[model samples]
Target: MGILNKFLEKTKICVIAEKYSVAVEYAKALGCSKKDTYFEGDKYVILWTNGHICTLYQPEDYDEKFKIWKVEDLPIIPNGFWIKVRPGKGQILNSIKKIIERQEITAVCIATDSAREGNLIGEYTLMAIENKKNVYRAMINALNEKEIKAGFKNMKEDKYYKNMTLAAQARDEIDWLLGTNLSRAYSVIYGKKYYVGRCKTVLLNLLCKREEEINNFKQSLSYGVITKFKNDNCEYAGRLNYALKSESEARSIVKDICNKQGKIDSIDRDIKSIEPESLYNLNDLIRAVNRRYGYAADEVYDIAQKLYEEHKLISYARTDSRYIKKSMINDVKLIVNCINIDKFSMKKSDINNIERFIKRCVNDEKVIEHTAIIPLEVESLEEKYKLLSTKEKNVYDVIVENFLNNFLENYEYESIAFLTKVENYTFITRQNKVITHGWKERKKQDKNIVEVKEGEYVNVEDSVVEKKLSKPKERYTDDTLFEVLENPAKFVEDTKLKKILRESGIGTNATRALLLKDLIINGYVTRQQKYIIPTIPGIELVKDIRTDKLLEPFFTAVIEQQLQQIQDGELDKDELIKDTIKFLERHIEELKSIVIPDKNNDPIGKCPICKRGNIVRAKDKGYGCTNLKSTGCRFFISKEILGTYIDEKQVKNLIEEKQTDVLRFKGSKGEFSARIIWNGNKTQFKKF
Candidate 1:
């Protein structure tokens, strides 16, 4: 027998924490005796649920017929949801059951994190056990002694949070209903297993569209003429805004402007000030850590949570609020003073200017359920910080930077612009001058700004036709992808729908990272360095399923709006459930016929070296001959070479003609055009 299970005979109450680390903390603050994983106090016996000890039963568990996926039986809407103990959690749960069942235990405490999902986890676990004891909710914002004691003192009857529980349960069932049913219907059509959800499927569609756009994107090379001017003030260059359609036109413009006289038309200088970044909300923290350390959103969240739970080094990591109350300025200052100032290159004069910038950091209206993430005020923080892992320190530094930067002055600069005219052509140049090295402390560029009187004539020394290539939009990086997920309204065209989506987004702050992680785990998405790329299998899933109702952000936004209404008790949950089922029924019956290409059945082209084999997509990427096993042929082509993305048409042309048409490739010196030659033996690049 463990600590609480064996010695709970004298327990006055039992406590259930959301996670093990939290349970351990409660044990300390409650003066409980710890043994094994459970703790025993004079009045309280405590253990942990380890996050959702019980979850809803899967479709297979509900019935044997549902075990095998079939389109006919899809849209698997259950009559009622039931909870069962999750796998591998039976031992701790049994221990908890034993602890709570003791006659000495008069009441139970639900000390889980204060959130909708946390409420669900605790409520579901209790529901699975069929506990009859009186239950109370302990909403803990921090894991300190004062906060824990305050939480217990202010604990309310579980019945008081019934709406929150109901809201969470409704969301849980709706997600299970939608994700489980829709994934099954789509997988059947895909001819292989595929995961799909309202949020992730749309994200996958966006990724696949990006991949297609990149492959189909053809760079149009254009030329422009620039006149280099040399005068007593400085040597500078400028150009007209228009791009020359043909090289001959650019050459003619250059010839006309070379060695010609140009007069300064106007000179404008303006000073501007940029404020420091806002406090670290969950989204902002995720973006900052991802940008600075190349960590994914999920990893950043995990690290941030560890900092919150284990070290108690920062406030709540899952908060959405980027503002604190105006009264918390002293609290923020305490933190800044506690931490070592070695990394922060602050100005001494900025210390007296703290009151000037305090307005940017504090706003009572913006403060929500929790305050912004800031370093906890502690004297030992500097010592404890040195023992942290590099990643933890990196994420911590970003939070600290955001907090400390608020005390500094605004980043101010001066922008000087000049416009020049040579004959009928006009040109412009801009130079930025740094004034205040505040938050960013960024320096000026290499270009020098020179003074010029209006209407003063200057000599155009030389001119040349500048070749420019306008490429397609960049691939989706984690940073950009997170932004899109947070603000999905950008993907839609309707202004009203955009407004709704901006309010609720695709997913909640808590679920966004986990959703992205699940997509990556199931092979629908992947991380190629900083980019979140959609795989070929991922592309095949959403290639033809895209429609305005399904692909647009409005779809998920409507679900969010309905869920919010249900949470607010404005609409009956059963009504939402009925509408969801009807939606599934309509969508399943109306699913578009998408031709998922079978590579084995439909190859791109025949292999040039080995005519017996057909070229198809390789495992990771690119294309390779199918007869590599039988004939030992090694013919293959990559998707990219020298930073240029290749298309399927190029692969087909290379196989049929034994040589490809001139294509652009990046060389060591610069970007150049080349042709691939298959000389009966191997491939060779023929550069122009």
Candidate 2:
């Protein structure tokens, strides 16, 4: 008997949270006291529901109404949808219901996380089982045990989360209603698998637009003048952007400029060093890790999720806040001190000095509920670090090292720019040098310089006029791609649409990385080195939808606004879904009228299997299919479903010679391996 049950004798309560651990954590805090606890004395019981114990029943689950995408079903809306304990979670549901049936239980307390999903979990569970018990809700933002206990101590009526529940219900039913209908409609019409969600479709369009930019890129030529001059001890290089039509013209100008005395027209210098970076948000961390190491966003997400859930070193890895909360200041300092002691081996006095400096820099207003990602405890991180693979270890090092440096002193640097003018030619040189290494002292940093201003006369040592060609537009890496996705205005020229995109979370942090991987795996894009380049099919898809709003970033942004409204209590979720449906209907009709070709017609390639048909790529599978016979030969190569990218050359080799030149691949189960060739068939694996 907990303390709360005695004070509120007739009330029953339930604790629902996003994860089992969260619910259990909150429950422990309250139940620790016997008698008069939140529920025991009140004759209340705490029932827990897993995250999304029930979802809007699938379309096929509603038979006769299925496969028809018409407005007559306008709200083909269910008066109420059927709910069941998720098929595999019978044990959990049974346990909850068993507690609910207890003799003394009189009221229900809803202690879910204060989020949309949390509300839905409790609501659907009650409705499904036909439990009409009186319910009260308790909401709190933090996951700490103290906060949980306090929230129970000062409980709010369940009616407080009613609107939130409505919002969640709306989101679920709408996604079910719109996603199912549109997906079916398109899949039927196009005879291909396609899926669209309020947010995911917009993300797809963003990628398609990027592919368009890359494919349509036209390379051009431009000229720059480079000169190498020697001073007393060293040689320096400077470049002049002298617009010239040809290399010969550029060389002629260089010759004329070098002949005259080079005088320093202007010398500008400023010295400053970069400070250590603050903690990273999910996006910032993803971008940095992607650039510094070739860690894919999805791979990094996996690493981060592990760091949070399994290792328990980082707090809530999916957050967007880059600043730590005021309450976390002391904890942050302690972490910094521990890192300096364990990893960097700084003396206690030095650690204390750095800690004081870090403490001084703390600001409360900058943080939200959760702080930027830093290790909660060094032991957890170090233990996990030892078990990680080489790739995972490198990424972990980035986070650990960054955590160490965030508390360190600032770096100082000197920057100098000298301008020289000779016979109508302007030469510019810029140089930057480190004055105080600061953070750079611990980590090697890359720098480039382009000037030497020792004395008056500039010495010319060497000169070259090489022909230069324009470069194609760059492709998306998991890093740069999000910038374009999250803030489309930066890449787009449309003024109105950009404003709309800025307000929406282009892709939720949880889903953004997976979407990138999907685009590459689907033959919509290809990876060249570390870059994500679009394929021919992707280019064609973009061309087909170039002018459609459904294919643009703004579409996703608008939906995001509605989602936010749902969260903010400004809009009912059902209305948002209805609006989304109506919007999609109009959009899909317009899209159907446009002339879009079949998959094969986009950019047909010779089939490597039969040499009689074309190769086709689809969502679930990619293979060479011969349309000549009723049953065609399907030589399929899955997109990372089974293995890494198997290119056209590999496909060609696989079929023509019956052996695939020892197909090397990263194993889904273990390390890298290759298929050994034997008598034109596959044989044993050779380990790497």
Candidate 3:
């Protein structure tokens, strides 16, 4: 009876949050009683982790040899990866396991941050459970009382999040495989800890490319002839249709057209409309904050997290999707009414006009995991604004405007493409007339307006030459870098690669800022005010390395997309791993070509499977790797296998070409000719 009573106590559901504060909100909304380190009610229990309690093991954790950097270890590709409890985090993981093991704890519901990384933490922590238990997912996008209740009411089976888990795992492994091997290879070659990364390498290369553009830029002067012409409506300036490289040429044209009779050859008028931009994904919000208030990407993320997790002021941060769900229309209605329109320069009338614009933001198909970041309907929202830090306020305003921009009407304008003929020269004049200020009025007080008519004769009042100088490409600020990562197609050249990158951005937006931060910490780049300038070491490192495929943004971005494909079950993770290994092999070859000094003299070159190992002859004992003794590498070729004699040149062929030319051998069945090859394992033979 006593055991049964304890088992009955397990009827309560468990909640796990990414942080204590979010867990507190979950507990409060569920009416749970506070415990020492958790909250418990008759039907619920809440637990939390300080972000992540477990993480993927480092390279050194796999083998002690990896602890010391060696160029000979050009690429360390693990057959399998492992995850362990983060250091100093074992206690919390223990507590979570203990709580989950209780008899009455019927099911577990993950309430971690709604993201790929958070899914990893939740699933990985649960690996500690000794027995199977029912699992659910609590998708709380906001920590408000209403959202928390709704999240619990709509709990889903944990299997629903399998894709998220897979994506995070794939990304982690990719990073580990690339970062560990490449960092070691470059650091050893460059004689410094270069600390290469999957994403940061591309980012560093972008900076270096930009630096080269600036250094190599040659400022040249060009001139154009401008003439002032008057019609009945107004006098306007028109430029010649062509550019002149010399001032004398521009002046000659100007002198010829001066005081000349001219007629408007033709004028084309058309009305054009520009729709408002989509709402705020975390990346979009970060870019906006950086542009307006100059906050770093990480800082904006921190503030946004605080808003979503603590203040209950915004939707989930770190989302890549920009469209709110069509089902969330009610939530949208609630939020717009709750915010202070007066502060955002929005009128009560504008709120009424939001009906049509609201349709543009709602799309069930576009919303993936979470909707765009949006302000929530909270009490004292206006008062909350006044108390926020200056930077916080700036970020909040951009997020709010991102949503509000939808409420405003589309900006409409009329453009006139006018052409005037002077002698044999054709002068072009273009003007924009504002048809509807719409959203434009919210930002600008003045709209440049000019009206023109076709076939109108006019006299040239004056003509002069105008000189212009081209400017070098601008350096990347946090805003522009965020944009580049989201849309690298503009910079990338390959059509297929660019298309893939366009669909799946260069890196995960949630982690881009953190990776950028690592660049500075590792002495690759520096933040000069708004610019991410590459250091001398940074520039040299990019130039010195020759891992062409690994250095491309398209490679990293496509890997990111493949992770998504893995999540969607469209691609198998194991297959992705196998493909990655093949690519890693190629990348390692590229690194070795640049003289990754051999640490040992095994003569026959490096092992194709275990890249660090060297092949050597045991004096008529055939050939095997030197690392076979230390690392248990399985690489060997018997001098006489199946009545076939393997020679020195054959051993070199096996090492370099991964195979030896077909030779006669005696098998159990009959005499056969086959190629001795490293069949991804011990010695084997393949017949053609």
In candidate 1, stretches whose alpha carbon ends up further than 4 angstroms from where it belongs are: 1-11, 345-349, 353-358, 442-448, 462-464, 544-550, 591-688
TM-score of predicted structure 1: 0.86
Identify the leading candidate in terms of TM-score: 1
Cα lDDT for residue 526, candidate 1: 77
Error of 2 at 124 (Å): 3.2
TM-score of 2: 0.73
Model 2 spans > 4 angstroms off: 1-14, 17-51, 65-85, 104-115, 133-164, 257-260, 271-278, 340-369, 377-397, 400-404, 440-455, 491-500, 517-529, 533-547, 588-688
Candidate 2 positional error at 636, Å: 19
Task: Give candidate 1's total backbone clashes.
Answer: 0
Candidate 3 has its poorest 10 consecutive residues by lDDT at: 1-10
Pick the winner on TM-score between candidates 2 and 3: 3
Model 1 C-alpha lDDT per residue in residues 234-335, reported as the tens digit of each score: 678887758878999889888778778999899898999988888878888898888888899999999999998998888878888888877667766676
Q: What residue runs in model 3 are displaced by over 4 Å at the alpha carbon?
A: 1-10, 72-74, 77-79, 129-131, 231-233, 345-347, 353-355, 442-448, 491-494, 596-688
Worst 10 residues of 1 by lDDT: 1-10
List, residue by residue over 126-230, the lDDT tens digit for candidate 2. 776677666666665345454566667766656766777776676677667666756555555555555545555565556555544433445456677887765
Native-to-model Cα distance after best TM-score fit, residue 560 in candidate 3, in Å: 1.6
Local distance difference test values of all predictions, in order: 0.79, 0.60, 0.78
lDDT of 3 by residue, 485-569 (tens): 8888887678998899899877777888888888888877887667777775676678766866656788887788889888888
